[model samples]
Target: MSAGDIILIPNRSDNYIYLLRCAKSGVTAVIDPGDAAPVIDELEKRGWQLDIILNTHHHNDHVGGNAELKEKYGAKIIGPTAEADKIGGLDVTVAEGDTVKVGELEASIYDVPGHTAGHIAFYFPAVSALFSGDSLFALGCGRLFEGTAEQMWHSLIKFRTLPVETRLYCGHEYTLNNARFALTIEPENTALQARVSAIETLRKANRPTIPSTIGEEIDTNPFLRADVPLVGKAMGMSGATAEIVFTEIRHRKDNF
Candidate 1:
């Protein structure tokens, strides 16, 4: 079966709420609906029935609209089993390796706990779309609020193995700022420099700079380049382990 069509819905300052619709089955799922009004309105606009509420974590910004949407559409809420009690209205609790279907499409759940201990991500192999809530961003990674730098690094390593063509659908519109921080650590990276130029134009136009390909991120994101000699050298850790370089870079970004 083919994967569903996806749309990014801008929500609450910088967060993105993803909407996935199966063309063949006409089933629709809203991912990380921080707010209900916009989602409700959008469903009405498309005359689509909301069938699922897919959450990545327990953060209020990610699960705030759970009750409202569940009440409104009787949508089944699927969330991380680790945070089922924290995230209200969950109908299915999933963990790593478990799969959830969106109409004809199937998404594999991954435990990417770093941004939060219970944070997870959904990956649709058919579409190569990764709904990386707070764990991974375009040119950056998530802050260590509930988890540690070590945990975050390990979590990112899992993503490093995904196909280069995979598309990253992260939660925030933090690419512009992340690009600036990345340039500081890898000033001579031509790929990042080129991406920064393009990002500047997009920001000037008030456009989104996300849904970046995994290949693009591998070439540009400093976090994803921790193993590269230049990136490690930039942090004065040229001989350090990849994990060490990753930790240091994350520390710098924490203060950036």
Candidate 2:
């Protein structure tokens, strides 16, 4: 029932590896360990044993270290039920509404299929944190790799329903580029303009612009602002349905 310590590990290019450690129980879990060397090294450095390997999808970059980590630490592997066969060393398959526990921390699983048909997210209500994988990002959303714009929109809507204080930990460090693209969609949005400025400063210092709060994304992320009048007007789709506006924005991003 307590919040955990999260270690953000920058992995292979733009990917991220999150190491969650329960402060109360000293239990540790590796979320999306695309590479095992760093996770293993960090675990040893902290004298923490790996107890869980949690995957949001079966993408190679996300699960590439699954087998090695599981075999090395005897950690139980958990992944999306829809992608169980595709993910290596999976011991448990979960879907929306299911729950996973890491020591005293309990996280709710969410089916956020869009980046991939079986993509999912993990939400730790106790910590007000969401491991959104690649489904949602700062100032942007994942591409419809195996799903449609409508599906991605629905997935985003599901995330938006979480508490505004919920902080999202996305899979990639694409915020700088996403912020630039978002400006094109909502150039007049003051929140977005300010966020872009802040993002530039952070990136210049090589800092991560992640763990963005739902409230911040709601106010600044173009992908999440499709329903706003200004966003719709910019796309020449004023009064358009959220789905339609989202689709247009997604399409434009594909070309952007």
Candidate 3:
């Protein structure tokens, strides 16, 4: 169970499609393919056959390419059991505490419902990577479309418990905008300020500001810091509970 090699492929608008290959068994998988063309092109370029399609939620952009990829390569589609009806073509449906294997690599599933109820994340401890589709982002969490702020906060708490070094492979490229919005929340945070500068540089160079570690997010991401007293004070809600503070943060972000 060696660390796998993960490739980030940008897709429609800001969606991200990750292609991962197990170092030990050469198993290839695509995570949240928003479109089939880009995934197919990348697979052809690398001359690797797609072995599995791993989806996190039922969003159209997340599972859009499932049928085409499965049809072309006979790949198995593994997605969240809660969203089984919405996410068609799932050969294997998994829930929280379930384990999924890709060749010699294994991933633990976590139920992280926020942007969508029943959304799940895949954590490959062997590689210290979390393919967090739409639940947690670089400096923000996904919008609470079908779930509550409390639910999103709890979901983020699950992410916070992971090892700080875990590399977060989120589903979108919204770091730049998220950074700006985060600054509005914590104007004097030195770490957040420094991260903003770095994010600006990366976007200017047309580079992805992804794979942000959990430690980095914990330091600069306001969404993850809702439980901290400083964050509550900054929001003018001193001594508020984490859930109340988190709800305010989400409300501001929704309007930001």
Candidate 4:
């Protein structure tokens, strides 16, 4: 299958809505439509019709446009099975191990519950794209809103196992803040420092620093590096388990 074209649509402060078009089948889908206006505008601009609405969670910023988009284009609303009630207008409720098809492209669903109880992510290995929503970010992870640190840690671990080159498409544009917080954790990390510099340049130009690869996050994101001895040592928990180290990192980020 040919790789699909992914377009970034910025809306509602920092929220990101992705419009994807399958190259081979010409099928179109929107991932996490935080607002209908932007999604509708993009679709109309491209002369494309929406076929599917993929929601990662029930957060307002993620599913707020579901009803409108569905009503307008008769798009199929596919969302997490656990939050089917919370996410109204869901045409298909999916869980881990299920596969969702967007035209000729197929995505593997992962039950990534941390930012929200029913949070999930879609991974299209063929294209090396992961629509992570709020579960993971460019240089950070989402806050533990409705889940525990342990749950969030495990959820991140799932992402860590993906191919190093997998492109992560998260829900928000929090990379600048996340990069600053990450510097506080690993000031000595040259890789992190360089990434911070690049991120600074991107933010200065008001460009999105998103679609960060898994390998980039592994080398720089403090949350994803909780298992590294350097990260644990920096937190004064060198001998502690990864979960314990991760909890501390999350706590500090909450206040940072």
Candidate 5:
């Protein structure tokens, strides 16, 4: 169930669209394509045809190429039904509790509405992979663009329930900036300090810091790890549950 080669096609300066290829199955899916040209280029270069187009939300940057790709390649476009009106050519409009298929592989759908009122994340249980569109990132969660802090908290909590090994594939490349903000909340977290060091190197080399695992994010990402007692205490909120601490950290990041 391991991913074969995850390709990163940099777009829009800092934005990146990732393509996942399964080795044994040759099943391929594009995650949050901001533009059609790069996706078309990559597929043509590999002599591959896109089988599925998985979207996290309906932002232009995320779904800009969805319509083109669907028409050109006949790829199945799967997105949250709550935004079905905006998710162009949506073949399968899903909600929480629904399961979507990519070839023989199945990804469980979660209605993670925080960044947008209808944002959805795809979690492939067999491969331990989660495709979280704009809703979640490496060290941060998306801003409260269309939902409340409480809604975002609930979405984050759902991801917290995933197995520690689940590998998370989010929609953007905002780790470096996110880590800086995280430091303001939990400056002493050793795990975060180490990740900061590693990510700095990755950034310096102009590499993409993505496909972050649920366990790795849980240990280092303040938005997801605020449940740790030490973290809860750092925010000047004693005895608050981890989710509450998590909520506070998100609020701070929003304004930071």
Candidate 6:
């Protein structure tokens, strides 16, 4: 495996569980295990020992395999402290601004509460990677499950402030659906149109759409580009603030 190689394990049809392996150290840390079988298979295939399991939220699709993996590999279960009650067998509950290490890589946790009121994204500044679990998706954002629109907006903005080259590793494979809705808000964005076509092709091939970069998302993602004037006009909410328009767009997607 390449150094710092990310292996994506497709789970539950739409969800993705990732394994981050340090090629130099032979250490592996998994990010969200929705199922145990696939993770186990991957680990066994490589004869790797899981050092840590990172959980962004308590959602079953994110933490379902925690107990089993922790038991089998003796991996440390790291979860968000804000939703301690939701996570099982959490050995270390972290909060925003806290740092966790995966081999030589250091992940800085951000409290991005919206999808689950305690959802956190891990930022590896050195690698320019963000593990956004159900919070941000390509051409989309997570539903307002336990957070207000304003709160979610703020959380997303926090990510926007990161380096534009940062890579985003989201939890689910929702690119096709998100890309469809993106056109409603950004009809003038030919980049969005082209990206949507690419995503559609990937979906038809049953390939996972993930590991998108912040720059690409900024260019084509409607949710992340609510500040664009054309997007605001397309939403039928002219003269409205970007935040207001973004909320409306999110609502429309929620009901769709």
Provide TM-scores for the models: 0.97, 0.97, 0.98, 0.98, 0.92, 0.95
Candidate 2 weakest ten by summed lDDT:
1-10
Candidate 1 per-residue lDDT, tens place, 1-256, comes to 5557888888999999989988788889999999998888888888888999999999988888889999999999999999878987789999998999999879998898889998999998877899999999999999988998778888887888889999999999999999999998999899999999999999999999979998998898888888899888877787998888888999899999
lDDT of 6 at 83: 91
Clashes of each: 0, 0, 0, 0, 1, 0
TM-score of predicted model 3?
A: 0.98
For model 3, the superposed segments whose C-alpha errors exceed 4 Å read none
lDDT of 1 at 119: 93
Tell me the spans in candidate 5 whose CA falls farther than 4 Å from its real position.
1-5, 22-25, 241-244
Top lDDT hit: 3
Better of 1 and 4 by lDDT: 4
lDDT by residue for model 2 over 123-157, one digit each (tens)? 98877889988999988999898999988888888
Candidate 6, pairs of clashing residues: none
Q: lDDT tens string, model 5, 1-256?
A: 4645567788887777878777667878887888999999999999878888988898999889888888898888888889999877888889999998766667889998888999999888766788888877999999888987778878887998999988877777899999888888789988888998888999999888987888888888887766678787888987997667767887788688
Q: Which stretches of candidate 2 lie over 4 Å from their true place?
A: none
Model 4 compared with the native: what TM-score?
0.98
lDDT of each: 0.90, 0.90, 0.94, 0.93, 0.84, 0.87
lDDT value, candidate 2, whole model? 0.90
lDDT of 3 by residue, 1-256 (tens): 4478899999988999999899888899999998899999999998899999999999999999999999999999999999999988899999998999988889999999889999999999988999999999999999999999999999999989899999999999999999999998899999999999999999999999999999999999999999998888888999999999999988998898
Candidate 6 residue lDDT tens string, 116-161: 8999999987667899998988888999889987788778878888
